[model samples]
Target: MRTVRFSAVAAVTAAALTAVTACTAKSDAEDGTAIQVTAADSTCETSTTTVPAGHVTLKIENKGSKATEVEIVFPDDRIVAEKENIGPGTKYRLTAEVKAGEYEIACRPGMKGHGVRQKLTVTGGTTVKRDPKLDKAVADYRAYVQEQADETLPRVETFAKAIKDGDLEAAKKAYAISRLGWERTEPVAESFGDIDPKVDVRADGLEPGQKWTGWHRLEKALWADKKIGAEEKTLADRLVTDLKDWQKRVGTAEITPTSMANGAKELLDEVATGKVTGEEDRYAHTDLVDFKGNVEGAQKAYELLKPVAAKNDPALAQELDRQFAALDKLLDTYRSDKTSYDFVSYDKVGKDDRKELSDAVNALAEPLSKLAAAVVK
Candidate 1:
């Protein structure tokens, strides 16, 4: 058996680690005080339990044999800061604007199991007065996510029907189109337990005793094996059903400005780590299409938050605009005549072009990570 190294899977795992913090590590601690946090196989050690309530930078290092991730969760279970995909000896920095309150620090080693956690207490800082504008932005973003879900539910039905009909040719065409809606709303889909897996789980990560199902399973059957069986039809039906249920539930889901900003950064991280590697659409060679959808979704979140972010921190807002535009322009060159992106198989993508896309995404993500902090300032 061949040892398959799915770099894209590893990247997704890494991106999940720091879903809360997206900014690049600062060269100088000019804006915030730096605190050291170390992760090992059994322990998550912080330099201090208490921090001033304001801009706080967590400089997290993995001193473990396996990949590790650290996250700071609020009393309400909201993530305020995190960094993931820290290799055996790697380090990352995440800066967050914090309120004076109790928080929790958690560390997951090898990216499995419930993480070791410790209490984190913030002091000597006042929470900012609540802003109605920021609240409205959060509400609007949720509505947008709900709207995407509403649009995607029907498309999923179409894709599933093609598979159920055993029309491999039609299924192949519908597969990519169906993914656009899901990709645009992936961050929210992920919040619905089991829905994301049922609709989009890749081949790499299957829970123990869990049979692999969903779109990727069907993708392999259709594209790799060139056969569609009863099993494929069943999986397709479940996917459409799951998506329908997911869309109904997402309308009233709780979402915050912090989550919106993090979602945007998360989507860019998806592009940087997975789509760039072409490992995401390995079977279909449709990674470019997925990449465009992820970027479009991220861009929407940023645009929705632009008003409040600009009011609080004009510099951060302007930087995001420039980076978003730069990334979009580069992505545009890959468009197919009939679609937003030209379909280039992962194996056929040039290294230079891959690097270009990867670099552009990272440039956007760094500034994007700072938006939540800026808005709360």
Candidate 2:
């Protein structure tokens, strides 16, 4: 294709053409002009919607294997008309008219994040631009949702399966993996911070034997530990529902009335899931013990690895730095409040209180060194 040189009006026209891809797509030949926009590096034209609140229908054709999301955003990149096309070569129709205002067209793959952004100018329609902050909330929600679906749910299922199989070793491994996955998603749980994990997730009636530690799995007889009775099933079912809801609602669609509603629904999902989740205090009192152990192990390993870190190796210092940093951050995130601010009382000490601080900081960084050594070839 030739690089089309443009005069002033032509330049504006190309920019406008780029903008035309902004809305949901539909043919309005009988009623008005229909501009077809194929997305980036793909022959799929985006969906376009007519404006000024008329009877309009925007048809989006996503000619790809993966699901695709298209949006008509405001000049400020707020989605105006949005549609999601699922699976390979799926077509979605958005039967809504764009109100008057300035907007742009943006499309992205379903699993992937946002995609190509094109500016769209809807003539004679009300353009309801979005508040930029809403976009951030949607993004944050999406990240959390991905973590829940990709990591949290799978981990939960693994743990449940392990317990169901009555395999102690598998249960143990699942427990640890579940912790990592849960930690990754725990921040979003803050939004639904009221869940009392003990009551919500207890394995009362389930027989001992193996390690049925997580909720939703039974050991031996039918919930013999029916401390919660049938209500437990209700909670478990709610958790599963919440997980699905989170998977669906946490998309980066426009903050339109519908998207706004979806945002609320996502929050609700968090609540439902939170209600059923047995919250293991990541920084539980026992975890402090583990953290301390990991730190010391890291430090000792690093100290040992230092000998292996050839003196001539330029990267040695940096690797040491990186390992220490990760350990420190982990410690900082989970360290007890007592140790975070106060100094450990030493027996024989001088005015060198700095030594105590060094001890504190080192305590956190010790784990990384040990971890590094264990993995070192």
Candidate 3:
């Protein structure tokens, strides 16, 4: 299952944008320095709609029954910054950089649909200096994300072609291949606030009245039902079109070093919550393919930030490197063809084998979680 993803922006011009969770939120809110937001099932209230552009802090409390998400988004629904999966009765502090412009404070109840919203106006504010090395990390990470998006389109086309041609076996072969690029850079793809739910939302993740489309929907048709029909053919074409949108929009996505680090951590969370549990590729049993993609994506981000992170906190960086290697080596043990993504079927793995994989993922995830703070410090 896919949870909501947090999105952050890199510094552009004299004003660099980024997001972090602030621990001193109570004091900040008490001092009236942070914007107070109250979220409920159908209502989203903010202390003020206007703020000086620069570093904006939101003190959010979810009073709703379900887990909610809050985002500062552009009018076109591009996420400026967001914090997802805020549980009921929980308070969270979300801090992000903003430029003077029009945006909205969106509260998504149950982490689905466009929930309640309030207008947010950012006024002129002073610019702050940023570390140049962090900027380079952002640039490189952006390019890598774009490269993955560029590569993913053609593979998706191949999968779509197989589905359209009614070649069940061929479609099965193409399914995992097409998803490699997506799984790698899912955070970037998900930043758009709309694409992920359309292209990647699992059956269980769907809300009421939501039409099931994209990979998993088609996966059910191919592997579970064992046949392709008219709806399946139409869905294949839709998948290609949706992914093309992702490819075109990749260049415009917001990127920051912290976001890259956070995204890397999210990938591991995805593995622990979905891939390792055998729930992601439930019908196809190709969870290992996705597991590799998530790890590769996380590692790519970690490598890009290693220089800065090492300088700030050498011990954390070293531990991260060691854990990542351990996890990779453990994963390699399951690969039938070491040169390819040909891992043994997840169903074939024994209970103890699954536990080993789970342990490896958790070991790396613990240290990787600290990467963002190390880089910024």
Candidate 4:
């Protein structure tokens, strides 16, 4: 789960109107026209505000002084697609399948705040034809997300129960187990906009006036404070309640073939930015557990989309398979048990070990980023 921050609605609306002229354009999946997005420190500018419903591509350049994030979002701020941590002066191509609707192209400089915005209108157009297998892949991915959510709740209950009972050791043991499903399916949960912050926000990620809740908050109390107080117990129950909301909402999350592919890459990004850095499970040092979960989730998506990706670009598919296997084997080396999540603690890992892991993730991420385009072909 990642921290979520939003800009004031009025400010976003005014900026969006000023950034782009409201104009209609005729374009479709076949047109292959790309929207040019330029992101700077205080502004987000889009070449056009309208496109026909189908596959949409953004050619993004970050002219910002700091790293930025770009997203295509609903008016209510649910993300359709996003590419995070675009370093200064870097370029990225983000592709997403969007239906006819009103949307916004948001650019968050420094990867914080609501960001600069431009209004986007997706006009009704002929649906892009897809292979029947792609549809099945989406169906299966939805089921996989649901199953993860369903499994997560009971484990979370056990964790919360341990907390309520004041059983610190039991709570600590259950913590990583409870988070496995969440780590696996975070991208789907993040599509909902509100759930992640409530259940996953870290103390540093919280905006002023935002109450600190979620797993990380409890994590600090358990491992850092080394005690579970009354406040921690109350937060434990809140965690279960928030996750229940996530479980109920999973079925309704927007899922597409490209989203699955993109989400797989996002999971790797999570590993690079959070898990590998030892920031995600800082207190407990269970970074490897989350790291493994993220990799498994990415693999599941790639495997589901492999048939189409392989057909479109056989070489890319072959490279992805090799890299994934290599990374998995490398991760296994750190696990003494080999059959469970019993990997070395992040703090115990040496600089060389961490570098090896980081290298493996980068090797896979480069090819995985191309999967979206292959599947959409």
TM-scores for every candidate against the unseen true structure? 0.78, 0.28, 0.82, 0.95
Across 5-24, the per-residue lDDT of candidate 4 in tens digits comes to 66455234554434543355
Q: Alpha-carbon error at 304 in model 2, in Å?
A: 67
Runs with alpha carbons beyond 4 Å of true place in candidate 4: 10-31
Q: Which pairs clash inside model 4? A: 7-114
Task: Kindly report which residue pairs in candidate 1 clash with one another.
Answer: 334-342, 336-342
lDDT of 4 at 321: 100
Whole-model lDDT per candidate? 0.71, 0.38, 0.80, 0.89
Candidate 3 versus truth, CA RMSD in Å, comes to 6.9
lDDT, candidate 2, 1-377, per-residue tens: 00011122222223323323345555564423344544432323544543454323344566555655565545533334444433456554333335655655555544223355554556664433433443444455455446544665676566555545555446444434343333333323322312213112233322223233223332211223323334433433454445444445334333232232222222222222221121222112122222333233333323433433334233654555565565455445433463542212222223353243345444433332222212121
lDDT of 3 at 231: 95
* Preferred candidate (TM-score higher): 2 or 4: 4
Displacement of residue 43 (Cα, Å) in model 3 is: 5.8
* lDDT tens digits by residue: candidate 1, 153-196: 77778888888888889898888778887787676666433466
Encode model 3's per-residue lDDT on 80-171: one tens digit a residue: 66767678999976655567899988887777665567788887755234578877888999999999999999999999999999999999
Best by TM-score: 4
